[model samples]
Target chain A: MEEILQLVVFGIVIGSIIGLGSMGLTLSYGITKFANFAHGDIMSLAMYIAYFIVVDLGLMGPTVFSLSFGWGMFLAIAVTIILLAIFSIAIDKLIYKKLRRDKSNIVTMAIASLGVGIIIRAVVTMFWGPFARNFVPGIHEAVPITGNILIKPDQIFIIALTIVVTIVMYYLLYHTKLGKAMRATADNPDLAAVSGININNILAYTWAITGALTAVAGIMLGIQAQVYINLGFNLLLPMFAAVILGGIGNPWGALIGGFVVAISSEVSTAWIATGYKPAVPFVILIIMLIVRPRGIFGSNI
Target chain B: MDFLIIENSYLLLTATGVMNWFVGFLTTFAIFAIMALALNIQWGFTGIFNFGVVSFFMVGAYTSALFTIGPPGEYENYIMGFELPILFGWFAAMITSGIVALLIGLPTLRLQRDFLAIATIGIAAILRAVALSTEGFVNRARGMNGIPRILGDVVSGPDYKWVLLAITLTTLVIVYLLVEKITASPWGRVLRSIRENEETTKSVGKDTVNYRMQAFVLGAMIMGLGGAIWAHRMTSIDPEAFNDLFGTFLIWTMVMVGGNGSNKGAVMGAFLCCTFWFGFPLIQESLPDILGNKVFQLREISIGVLIILFLLYKPNGVIPEKPKISRHL
Candidate 1:
């Protein structure tokens, strides 16, 4: 029972990380109407950008609150989020904007994003040299909350951060005019345009927000694991699984789906070899596609 | 006279080496051409989004090897060494791939296009995970080796390379003609209709889903055939060799560059892309250390850039699909 509980905790930690990534993915998909294969690589790019700030820039400050990374890492993450938002907007202007003007299908956009993903990965590899590195380069100690229920302070921080981000996301989507505009555009681009909502502007804002979310997810992933070139690419499937599971365009669905996927995959480790953990989410994804293509929450933006 | 004779001998040897290299190049080209043609059927003609091309390729390779590798020795710890002929293995490969495709496509083909893409990516990842983790199934990380080579008993050395090249080219030609023929038929027209508009096709009483499933399975089977040929040529199999980037995305690039919906374009794309992909590495050797060290990465970036540029500038590719004209025209 304790072992199962421990596994569940681990699952939830991983789930939150996946949840964050999926929310960004779902947001992008909601507005763009195409699955952004590059979203994972965006996360990877964010990680590298943060790594540059904290490590390459020599900004390693003291570790905070039993966490593995320092204030420098936090600063790096903030800067990366802002930079990534700008980057996403720039990319939209450069690549997706042209495609959108051409009125290409969603599959074409998806493939283009796949190409973007490849380029991003290659850039990451070129800069980082395909090696694993940590922000602070030390094993985070796991503090036991109960019998055999040990959790890392870093893990707790990740969960708390995810919850806070979720709340903020909720507020933004519900309370903000930009968010309303974004949702309206996602619901019906033709209608939105006819109604005098600037589709392009909403798209730009969507990219920025999704970019910010992707960066946070990437940093959290790096903190949980280690920063590596394939870090984001590896998370691609799980994130997609979560997004599809939650509902393609629905942010809340993605958040919930992330936890569902992560927990299922993590817990399946007890029965199967640890290496096959990736398969669990895939199975869930396939089954979900077969049974209910709309996903658990349905595809509302 | 002695000096002249020596020079002639050296020239002869060099000629033979070049011939060997050319043959080897064409052999692999034919293999990829076959797979690209397979992809052309799925994505180009049928409009099926199959991102997991590598899964069927891997399955075909492993299946053929398992069927033809014969019995394992004590402690070898592998299963299903049927000791069958290579021909049987090839058939088995195609059938297995088709079945796998049917299983996956049955549900997803009826859904939105995005579902098929998502499902394929998932399947590819799952298959890879399975192949890597299951020690008893595929010999784990060490990979399956010592499979019997195609025509090993009769052929040797340089002659064997030529023979294998002949076999692959023959298979490629057969497949090209087969798909070409089917795609020109009424059945193919139905597929094209579905690709153009599924709802319209359904309204016309054409079973769009069934047609898609057939195209999907057939394409997967052809990919399997290509994989079986690849496995036989190498006489070994490994999970790492079937990386999605190489086996899947590169094929996609080939199909797109060659121009989808054109059989000749697929072959041409395979030829062009393979030459750059394989031949560029040789050029990398002569490059300065700084550039040479990152040649592979640079090539990857170039390919990505090429894909984006093509999508933007020349969406239809070098040889865009020709509109079907009336027979009188």
Candidate 2:
């Protein structure tokens, strides 16, 4: 029971991050109608942005509740969102828009996005080199949540933030004009166009939201774990698994799917060697594809 | 004047040697080009979007490595040798990868293209994980080394390379001939029809699934051959050698740039893109410190950029597929 509890806590922390990242990915896939292979790189890029702020700016002054962050990390999150948003939109405007206009096939778009991913990964490696860095140096003691079940403050912070973000996102999605327009655009682009929803603007907004969500997820993962160039790429399959499990373009499903994937992987370490942890989500993804390619919450698309 | 002549002659010899280094010997370009040919069959001839070309390549490499190595008789702590014949190794490579591809394809072939692509990637990831963790056949992370060369170590330098090249060219010709024959047949026509309009092809009573499976497996089989050839040349094997960026994506870019559906285009794309890929490091060595150190990463970025540009502007590739001619009187 203690082991299960610890695993659940750990799973939720990472799962929420995967959920957040998958949401961003699914949104872009929904609106753009193509998988953005660069989504993982975007997460990694966001982590770098935050890393630069905290480390380079020397803003590691005040600790935030003794968690694995400082005032500088908080500030970095805001800046990361802004910068990543612009970067995401620019990517869309440059690569995706050009490809979409050319009436390119889905595979071509996918391969192009993969190319984008490669470019971002290579560029990040060039800048950061291939080393892992953490938001804070020293490891803090794990606080006990229950009998023999201990959790990190940062993990707690991650869960809380995920809840808050989920609520805020739900409200924004349900009660906003922009959200409705976006949903309309995702559902039927032709219909949405006919209904006077500017598809391009909606797409750009989707990219922006995606950018912001990916930044938060990236930064949170960095805080909870370590920030590495391949963080996003490594997480790509899990995120895809989450997105597919939730149903493509289904935001609500993505949140649930993320937990499912994370838990499966975390629990898998018990049965299999830890070295094989990365393969868990992939196995899940294969099963998901065979069982429900349309996904649990997704409509036939 | 004598000094100038000698200098000019030296430069000429050096240039020839450099050229010889790239093309004259057992360049992996032959192997990559053959893999590209395989991809052309799968992606170009039939649109099976596989991003896990390296999985089969790995399968080919390791199978050949294990088969050709000396036999592990009594000692558990052996050099992990198998002592199989070279031809047996090569055949095993193709067959093993083909079987793996068939298994992967059986479930995935019916799914959407994206699902298939994702599944393939997943399979590749799993294979990599297995290679990293399991030591039974793959020898784990340390990797198996000193596997005997296919041709015994009697030949040296260019002669050795030429032998490898001869073997490669022969294999390439065989693969090319087979693919050409397959593509020209009614079965090949059916594959194109399936690629163009699956629904229409289905309506015409063609089993699109079988054709896809055949193409996927055949492509993988050739990839296995490529891997086997590569392993024999390197005389060793390791999992990391099959990293996807170069191992898989490069092949996709090659197929795309060479004209996806055309066999000749596959070879053209393979040569052009691979030359650029291997050529960059040499050029980078002469560059300033700031740039030279990061040339490898830069090369990846450039390849990435090249993929996007080619997809965007030259989707048809350099050598576009020829338009069909009418047989009407």
Candidate 3:
């Protein structure tokens, strides 16, 4: 019973991170109408940015904020988010924008994003070598609750941050003019353009926000495991699985789908071999596609 | 006499080393050409997005290795293996890979384009993870070593690679002719129609799903064939060799550069890209040490830049697919 509780707690913590990762993917797919295969790599790039700041810059104790738990996280996340947003916009302008202008096929765009991902990965490999490094210093200390359940401060932080971010994202997407513009564009780009919704601007904004969210997810993952060039590549499958299972282009669906995938994968590892955990999400995705092709929350493309 | 001596010696060395590298490049190009033509059948003609070509290739390598080497001795983990003849082993590998593809495609083929891509990519990753964990199968991460050499055993060590190279070229020619014939036929026209517009084809009473499955399975077989050839050439196999990101990216780059819908383009792209890939590293190595590493990084950056540039400037590829005209008119 205690072991079950522990696994549940751990699953939720990891599930939150996956949820955050999937949100970025779903949002980008929603507004851009192209699956950004480079989305996972963007997360990896952001984690490296935060790692450089925390370790190389030696800003652990001397940051503007007091070294309190909440303040330290706030600073780290803010810096990471800002840098990621800038990087995403630059990538959009340089690669995706041009591809979009040319009216290239979606497959071509997907391939181009893959090229971008390879370039990013190679650059990271050259700079950091092909080894893993942790962003947060020190091991996670567990906080006990009663005699059966215990949680790490990092895990707690991840859960809290995920809840807060999802709420904010939900609000932003539902109540804002920009959100409406995004949906309008996604539904029908030509129709949205005819109605004077700035499609390019909305897309850029979606990419920027998605980029920032991905950075948060990546940093959390690095803190939990370790930061590496292939970190995003490894996560690419589950992230896509979450998005597809929840319904492509549906952010809320992605949020639900992420937890479903993460928890199911973790729990399955107990029964099946650990190496086959990735197969869990894939199996779910295949089943979902055959049973309900539109996805749990997706509209027809 | 002194000048002639130095010049002749340098030329002789250059001739030997360059000739070997050129031959190696040709072998690699031929293998990739076969794979690209297979992809062309799916993406170019049928408009099916299969991001999991490497999975089928891996299956082919493993199947062939297992069949040729027979089962592991006592305390070994992998499944049944028979010491089949080389020709039979290759045939079995191709069939096994095709069956795997058929199984995967049967259910997933009904999904939308993007969903299909995601599903296939997931399947590829799952296969890699399984290979990594299945210790009894393919010796896990330790990989299979000491497989029997095909033509290499018959030829001298130095000349063995040349023999394998000849085989790959022969296979490439066979694939090229087969693909040309298929694409020129009525079946190829149906694929093209499905690619141009799925709904239009459906409205015209064509079963798009069945065609997609056919293309997908056929492409997997070709990839398997290439993998079998590649495995024998190297005489060793590992899970890592098949799962690298560069493996898929290189094939996609070759297909795009060659011409997505043209077999000739696929061959040309493989030759050109493989040469560039091999030659660029050497060029980087010749520079001063510090500068050389920097140049290597720059080369990677250039690949991304070139992909973007090509999409913008030549979206149809270097040699665009020629539209077929009817002689009856």
Which candidate tops DockQ? 2
Q: In candidate 2, which residue ranges exceed 4 Å CA deviation?
A: B1-20, B24-26, B72-80, B153-158
Candidate 3: stretches off by over 4 Å: A62-73, A299-301, B1-14, B73-76, B291-300
DockQ of each: 0.73, 0.78, 0.61
Candidate 2 lDDT over B1-329, as tens digits, reads 00111223243358766655655333567888899999988888889999899999899988888888876534222334668888899999999999999999988998888777777877887898888787464677766676667676666765676777777888888888888898888888888888888999999888889989998999999999998988887776677777878679999999999997888899889888877787666665468999877978888998999988898889999888786555782
lDDT of 2 by residue, A1-301 (tens): 6676778778888899999999888888888877777788889989988988899778777787958667777788889989999899999899888888988878888899889989988988888899998777887789887778888888888888889888877877778999888888888899999999988898888889899999999988888878898788888889999999998888888888999999888977777888889888887787888898879887422
Q: What fnat does each of the candidate structures reach?
A: 0.76, 0.82, 0.69
lDDT values, one for every candidate? 0.87, 0.83, 0.78
The candidates score, on chain A by TM-score, as follows 0.98, 0.97, 0.92
Model 3 interface RMSD, in angstroms?
2.0
Ranked candidates (TM-score, high to low): 1, 2, 3
- Which CAPRI category fits model 3? medium
Per-residue lDDT for A38-88 in model 1, tens only?
A: 988999898889889888998968888888878897788789889999999
Ranked by DockQ, top first: 2, 1, 3
What DockQ would candidate 3 receive versus the native complex?
Answer: 0.61
| Model 3 Cα lDDT, one tens digit per residue, A1-301 | 7766677778888888888999898877866667788887877887788777767766655323211133444667899898888888888898778877877767778878877887887787778767898765556568787696888776777888899998888778779998778777767879999999987898888888898899899888876678887878888878887887887777788888889888888777667888888898888878887887667877532
- CAPRI-style quality class for the chain A–B interface of candidate 1: medium
lDDT of 1 at A241: 88
